[model samples]
Target: MNDLSGLLGRVGERKDILLVVLLLAVVFMMVLPLPPLLLDILIAVNITISVVLLMMSVYIGSPLQFSVFPAVLLITTLFRLALSVSTTRMILLQADAGQIVNTFGSFVVGGNLVVGIIIFLIITIVQFLVITKGAERVAEVSARFSLDAMPGKQMSIDGDM
Candidate 1:
């Protein structure tokens, strides 16, 4: 029991170090040439992270409860963009990307390069215009409401005083 507690405590203390290491690894992937197998694994991990983020956003009770969401969003976006650049480099230089890219390119686009590119563009636009914009609007409205309610709240405090 003591050993397990000590291990957990140490792990908790090293979380920041772990995060830095992970960030460095992502940056390294952008510069290094990863094998197809590793690329596939990273792609799968990216998809899993995205799904987990979506679930977290859906199940969170309030925006304040997930205050780190914006940071998480930025990190994930950077990670994905790095992955895209790495994959593009592989495709251009070696003519082989990875299983995940090949599967998506083939299955989603049916081997039509133009259609695949168009679909990717459309999805990006929708995500930005619909999902991101909606979240921003909600945050703006919530802030305005909070400000509007402040006078009433202050009055209540004054009455109690």
Candidate 2:
């Protein structure tokens, strides 16, 4: 084990580099092709991570215990995006994504094209509306914060008093 340091060089101390490389790999997936086997493995890992995250959130008593939640969430979101892009590219260019995606499509569509299109549209619209609502809330909070931070507004209130 003494030689382990020279080999891997203290991975625990370089977690930031690991995270950045992982994120870069996710971005590279958008441009690179992935084999079906690797895609299946990645899909499995994504599902496992998502389930673990969900379970932790549900069981945890306080936020402090999972202070890295936001970072994990961001990384997972990017990973999912990359997987989606990669899967779509494979499906369009090679006519195959992976067994996991194929099984999921068959299960969701039930071998019916019309029903699948309808379901896809419904899901897309719901996602779009949810994101729009979240963005609206963020904008409202940002505007309110800006207004509250105005020095002239505070000064004017004090002068009136």
Candidate 3:
């Protein structure tokens, strides 16, 4: 029971660290003074999600859990695209390219953002998998050690009788 509690506490600590990092990174990105427009919002959202995913990868302590990384990236990318389309429509309806760029920077591309997003997603997934696997290996060894000691404990108890 104590062991389990300690494990849970450690997990919680890691989660807290991840959350803090995500929050700080997102806040910093948002403070860059970009115009309060759709593209700026999308960029902020994507950066936040990516940082969160990266932090999760660092904290999960196993490679098998890395499967979650790609999923996160996919969701973020979809949101980014949806936001981009709407932002583009609004910009076209309201102002010219210079105004849009002044407000949101050159976030819109001829589909390059999507390609870059995909590449980043793939890289994150791979990195997460590797780290998760390493953590799993360590866990496996610890479990085995505990399992091996149990019978010895039982044997000692039997001898005491």
- The top-ranked prediction according to lDDT is 2
TM-score of 3: 0.33
Worst 10 residues of 1 by lDDT: 17-26
Candidate number that wins on TM-score, 1 or 2:
2
List ranges where model 2 is wrong by over 4 Å: 1-9, 151-161
Candidate 3 or 2, higher lDDT: 2
- lDDT for model 2 comes to 0.93
- What's the lDDT for candidate 1? 0.90
Cα lDDT of model 2 by residue, 1-161, tens digit: 77996557777778888988998999898889999899899999999999999999999999999999999999999999999899998999999989999999999999999999999999999999999999999999999999888988889999999
Q: How many backbone overlaps does candidate 3 show?
A: 4
* Model 1 C-alpha lDDT per residue in residues 1-161, reported as the tens digit of each score: 99999998997899988778878988998999888888888889999999999999999999999999988898888889889888998899999998889887789999788998899999999888998888999999999999999999999999999
Query: Model 3's lDDT to the true fold?
Result: 0.65
TM-score versus the correct structure, for each prediction? 0.68, 0.87, 0.33
Pick the TM-score winner.
Answer: 2
Clashes of each: 0, 0, 4
After superposition, candidate 1 runs with Cα above 4 Å error: 1-9, 117-161
RMSD of each: 5.3, 3.2, 14.4
- The segments of candidate 3 whose C-alpha lies over 4 angstroms from its true place after superposition are 1-42, 58-60, 96-161
- Put the candidates in TM-score order, highest first: 2, 1, 3
Quote model 2's TM-score.
0.87
Pairing residues by index, what is the TM-score of model 1? Answer: 0.68
Better-scoring candidate (TM-score), 1 or 3: 1
